[model samples]
Target: METYDKIGINYNKTRKVDQRIASIIEENLQPKGINLKLLDVGAGTGNYSNFFSSKGYNVTALEPSEIMLAQASHNNNIKWIKGSAEDIDIQDNFFDGVFSVLASHHFNNLQLAISEINRTLKSKHFAVIFNADPSLVSKKSWLFDYFEIVFEKAISKYINIESFKSLIQSTANTHVKIIDYPLPDNLTDNFFASGWKKPSLYLDQTFISGISPLASLETNTLNLIQERLENDLKNGTWNNKYGQILEENHFDDGYRFLIWQKP
Candidate 1:
């Protein structure tokens, strides 16, 4: 919860759900009715909730981080419940659809979340969840593969698509139809996790928000990490193994979005 209050400050930075990805999610994860009662787990900062609420659907935001819920309350539009997906106190079969983005990896009790998801939704209900590349625990990216060694040493393990299947499905038949929305870039282990440092124009607070997903690190800690990364970039240690990237923008990693339905 503490992390979110701090993390929520920069939550919208590099992480707006790409409309390209959102379009696919919207197409497949659509509710059955116009005024559908929807649930958004890990609704950080209310960006996505606000987006859906704009369209006239009732969106209930369930976020574990109290700080995030506070920030999300900036808009008085949605129902903000301070709870994780696993421990959601709402009633059974309470929603037509449920969705969350970039917050799946932070789940402490993933199985509980899955069980809760199943318990809360009636038959025919759907839940959509999206998270970043688990293997991409490093800082380097297609734009900045040079920093991989540095970042790889400093990151933690992330959740993958297969883990979603194991966590959510009790039976083989009641499964999540996984759709991995990979970034439209190199998939090899050579690319960086954070991507190149962005073009000169993109290096402002925008960079702070849109750059790193390092939500756990404080500002000072983040600075130390960046300081080392900059040192590596300058000393040419990064470029020796990974060459300077010609292009800086436009990347799409196979960051998966698992779409589950109950019959």
Candidate 2:
């Protein structure tokens, strides 16, 4: 069974597409035009795939998890395929553009996946939106203070931005551009760090369950973290330390858009 298959039951309830991020993706691929033949590698639940399809792009939504794919909204413009990133079952130079959002960390082999993306992209343009190395972003995160172990583990899982840029450039001979994406206060998507400003949302079991790192924690660990967080919020301890962040409208928590294009 795929990893998301086990944890994706309530995914759609919280992982809706934030149009602000969607528009950025659209703008990145818009140069290719609406007739672009696009592939969404790791199209978990097809939120972005459906978004692009609705805008008139012919999108192939490839995902390894049946549970995630099953939850995708039915759309005539999207051709859904059950597949993995490292071994895409598509013809060579087939797609005009390819994109993946918040899904690369779960890949079994990052190098092979990049090779496959290069192999199948006719335009040799690949755009991926993912978290940078957690070490760079977690220093200011409340998660680092509360869920120390889980946050540390996540730091090891995420790729360093510089290393990832070098990898993409070396592997595919593509020019890579990094775009910083700050988490908006009103972000609709409830990913791991989306609740940066609204810390209380982390106390919700359903919300945390939708995040892989937090969801994977043992019951006791989660209970302890929740208890500590609740105490901090009630006593104004959390606000004393991190309350200044609440005044900001958005935060740059190492979320970035990496666009790779072959010259």
Candidate 3:
């Protein structure tokens, strides 16, 4: 069974598509052409796939977990396929473009996945939205203070941005243009770092369960983190150290858009 099959029960509740991020995805892929044939790799819950389909693009939503795909919206415009990125069943050069959001870390083999992406993509460009290495970002995030183990696990899983770019270029002969995506205070999609400003959201199991690192934690660790955070918030210790972040409307919590295009 896929990992999400166990942990993704409440995924759609909090993992809704943020329009700001969706608009950026649309804008970047727009140049490909109207009604282009697109593929959404690792299409969790099909949020972005449904978004693109609603915009008139013919989208093929590929996912490995049946549980995740089961939650996808019923859309005639999307053809949902059960598959992994390392071995896409599609034919060579089958898609006009492809995109994946916050799903690459779950891939069993990054190199095979990139090769498969390149093999199936006929167009010059594809987009991926991934987090910066947790090691670097954790230093600036209060989340590390509360859930140190979560960040430690994430650091082992997330690829370094520079190394990721190099891997893509080597595998696909594509140029990578990275754009920084700062988290908005009112971000609708409650991703892992989305609670940078509103720390209380992390205390909610429903909210944190949607995030892989947090969801993967043992019950004892989760309880300990919660207890510490609750204590800090009650005693103003959290505010004392990280309260200044509340003044900012947006934070560069190390989310980035990596646009890979053939030069």
Candidate 4:
């Protein structure tokens, strides 16, 4: 019945953990060795939460969707909690750090959520947020060329990086640092822009459905796009236009990480 329930079990199938992203989060947070407490707001299937917990940090995986949480892997080290970003149930100044990956757009009230995150973190610690900036994403992403509807919807929903920074600044008393986190050509995680270099992978039904924005699209629309893309690939039209990506190991795709620290 939940918004994300439709893709519950299938969520983890394509959405695996990418160490590159994990390492970036860890580096930004700069955890104080083992047993440090961390909070993962909007933790869909607890991918990052599980990874941090395995690294010896006590992690709280906070997710609003019950169906998605039901499918999350249980770990003794990670505590899975059902809650929304606007109102975290935990106590004040309880966590060493908090991070949200590609989930801020889901928050009904981003300022309130940032305030909640700011309130929950220990002073001088960090809260890291990662997402794609719509303005920048429109530049080089091929998804716009294929699935036009999905891209339009995503761009409308996602906040621009500058506006996001300003929102965090207004709501939280933290020093904000913006970091560019471009997707590697062979990224293990199957997020929206992950298939930038590997264009043909987007043709797979299972792969397309696993992506949140595209999954929300109508079946007919998806099928039409797939049909057109398949034809383009068969006739070499795709490579003729976007062949440069095949040689590159990474693409920017407007992915960014915002590190907020209370000082």
TM-score of 3: 0.95
What TM-score would each prediction reach against the true structure?
0.75, 0.95, 0.95, 0.96
For model 3, residues 77-166, the per-residue Cα lDDT tens digits are 999999999999999877877888888888899989988988888756565555466656747568777777877888788897778888
lDDT of 3: 0.82
What would the per-residue lDDT of candidate 1 be over residues 1-263, giving only the tens digit for each residue?
65566656655544454455555656666667667777878777677787778767788888887656655644545888888876988888888887877666667777777777767776787778776654543334533243343344333556556765666666323777777554543222112233433322222444454333444446675666566556766787656645555343434444677788866
lDDT of each: 0.61, 0.82, 0.82, 0.84
- Model 1, clash count? 13
lDDT, candidate 3, at 169: 87
**Best-matching candidate per lDDT:** 4
Query: How does candidate 4 score on lDDT?
Result: 0.84
Ranking by lDDT: 4, 3, 2, 1
